[model samples]
Target: MTTVVKHATIYTGTEKIEDGYLRFDQQIQAVGPMADYHPLVSDDQVFDLAGQTIVPGFIDVHSHGGYGFDAMDGNADEIDQMVQKMTANEGVTSYFATTMTQSHENIAHAMVGIKKAATKNPVIQGIHLEGPFVSPLFKGAQPEKYIEGPDLKAFEHWNELAGGMIKLVTYAPENANCAAFERYCLAHGIVLSVGHSNATRAQMKQSLATHVTHLYNAQRELKHREPGVTGHALLEDNIYTEIIADSFHVYADMIKLAYQLKGADKMELVTDSMRAKGMPEGVSELGGQKVIVQDQQARLENGHLAGSVLQFPNAFRNIIKFTGCSIADAVKMASGNQAREFNLTQKGTLEVGKDADLNVLDSELNLVQTFSFGRSFNPENN
Candidate 1:
């Protein structure tokens, strides 16, 4: 059966169309002005948006977990529940399951479970191996004991254990063994993101990698004399940077500055949310460390920023609030930019022939409806 969604202002990520209509079933068949309207069949379902905003389903390139479930917990049931409870309700149809700094054995164990859980789960696309190969100097919420430099053999073994589901790997370029590991990642079709490091400006320049993880939080500052990772991230136009935008991770001024410098094209808004998300304030766990969620932030017991309780919808709204950017530009940062980053060519943007993964928002930017795998579900009711 085909569905025609009409009477909405649609932001195709890069462009906007007023009074548009979208025809899709699993994949978008056509999308344009209502003037192009023609029913595929008499039985085709039609949805009247009544002047709402329609955008692609938000894609989170980096996330830990949500709804009281931690991705690193290695629980298949939790993954299943998260898929239905978190993403379906929050309009995040796709995401990466991010891991944290832990022992080699523990990290491998999480990968093993994530691999099995991702077999057919629509929400989890790939694994983001965030640590055990990072610098201790900048290991924010990661356990210090488990921190180490680039270990190619261990990484390869973990990748194998993960059933080759690892897509993004974050590491410090200051390590001695990084070149070989980077080579492995590139050759294996993995995205190597620089993060959790105290790398100098010269070292940052040498990295020339494509992605920077959690900009400014686990990273150093942009000093006049020393420069550093943050400086290069601000200056370089090629590398895409991740922004928490939760307002707690990075200051509001910094967020505005970054947006001013990078704009939506180079900025990818991520949640970096943890198990405490979608849960009431209290104690939680992340990478075996106890976390406290209060005042809308998640932090380790020792006062380090653990992760976050932010969901993608709130991140989408917060980005607009922080940057004062257009909903179209914020949509790009939240969805299209990440889609282009990971080659999810069919997954982002509300365009003809793309996947019919999209969300509908009311006038206030509240998620009202979601279409994932071509089925419409009320986000609030879900």
Candidate 2:
């Protein structure tokens, strides 16, 4: 059976088409002007969007957990609950099961859980290892006891436990023996992202040369003399940067400046949400460490940011409001750019032959409906 979504303003994430229509089976079959597409339909389920905006479903390259469940728990039932919560409420059709920095044994255990969850849930893209090899000076909320120097044996052990589903890894480029680790990751088709570091400008640049294509612009700040990680992220043209875009993680002015400098093609928005995301403020556990959530910010006892309680939808809205970017541009940052960075060819755009993963939003940027693999799930039912 085919579904015809008509009378919508389509932001393909690459282009905008007014009064457009899209036809799909399990994948997008056609996208074009409504008039040109009218004759292509026959006995199809038609949904008149009534001018609502239709865009590719948001893809989060980095996110930990949400809806009172932590991805690091390594529980299949708990991970499924997290996926349903994110997909039903926030329109995240696909995401990485991110793990926090933990002890070697704990990280291995978490990878086992992520592997099981990915096998059960098709939307679980892959695993993203976010620590264990990072600087103690900029560990943020990561437990100090779990922080370790760069060790290939540990990586190999984790990879074996994960059954080789680890798709992305995050590490401070300044860590000891990082150059060898970077080469290993690149050789194995794993994406290496720099994050949670205090590397200077020259150090950051040198690290980027070592096959680090992505940067996590979460904790570091910009400085004139030091430049820091954030400066290299903003000034570099070839690197893809992930911004929290929650207005609290990064200032509005800096968000706007990043958009201006990198454009929507190279900037991706991620939530980095914690277990308390989409829930009330209170105490929570991030990778077995205590976290206090107050006023939507998750922090450790030492005043370091633990993670976030913001969802991808809120991040999208904040990006638009803060940067004055078009809805299309904001959507591109959340979907298209992420797909490009991760080399996911068939999951990002609304073009023909792509997956039928899409989000339908009202005029005010509120999610009205979503489709994952042609199965429509309404958040109102939740």
TM-score of each: 0.96, 0.94
After superposition, which runs of candidate 1 have C-alpha atoms over 4 Å from their true positions? Answer: 380-382
List lDDT for all candidates, in order: 0.85, 0.81
Report the Cα lDDT for candidate 2. Answer: 0.81
lDDT by residue (tens digit), candidate 2, 1-382: 7898998999997789999989998899899888787655363689989869998999987888988888888898899878977887888988888888887777888888888888877778877888878777877777778888779988988988888877788788877788788787888778877776767778877774322213444435677777677777778787678888877777788788888988888888888898988778888888777889998899887777777888887888998998899898888888987777777888888999998999999998888888887878788444
Candidate number achieving the greatest TM-score relative to the actual structure: 1
- Residues 1-382 of candidate 1 have per-residue lDDT tens digits of 7888898999988789889988888888888989888776553789999769999998887888888787778887777677666556789877788988887777888888787777757667778899877888898998898888888999999999988888898888988878889889988878988889888988988774778899997876788797778888888898899999888998878898999999889999888988888888999898778898999999888899988888788888988898899998998898888888888878878877888989999999988888887877775454
Kindly report which residue pairs in candidate 1 clash with one another.
none
State candidate 2's TM-score.
0.94
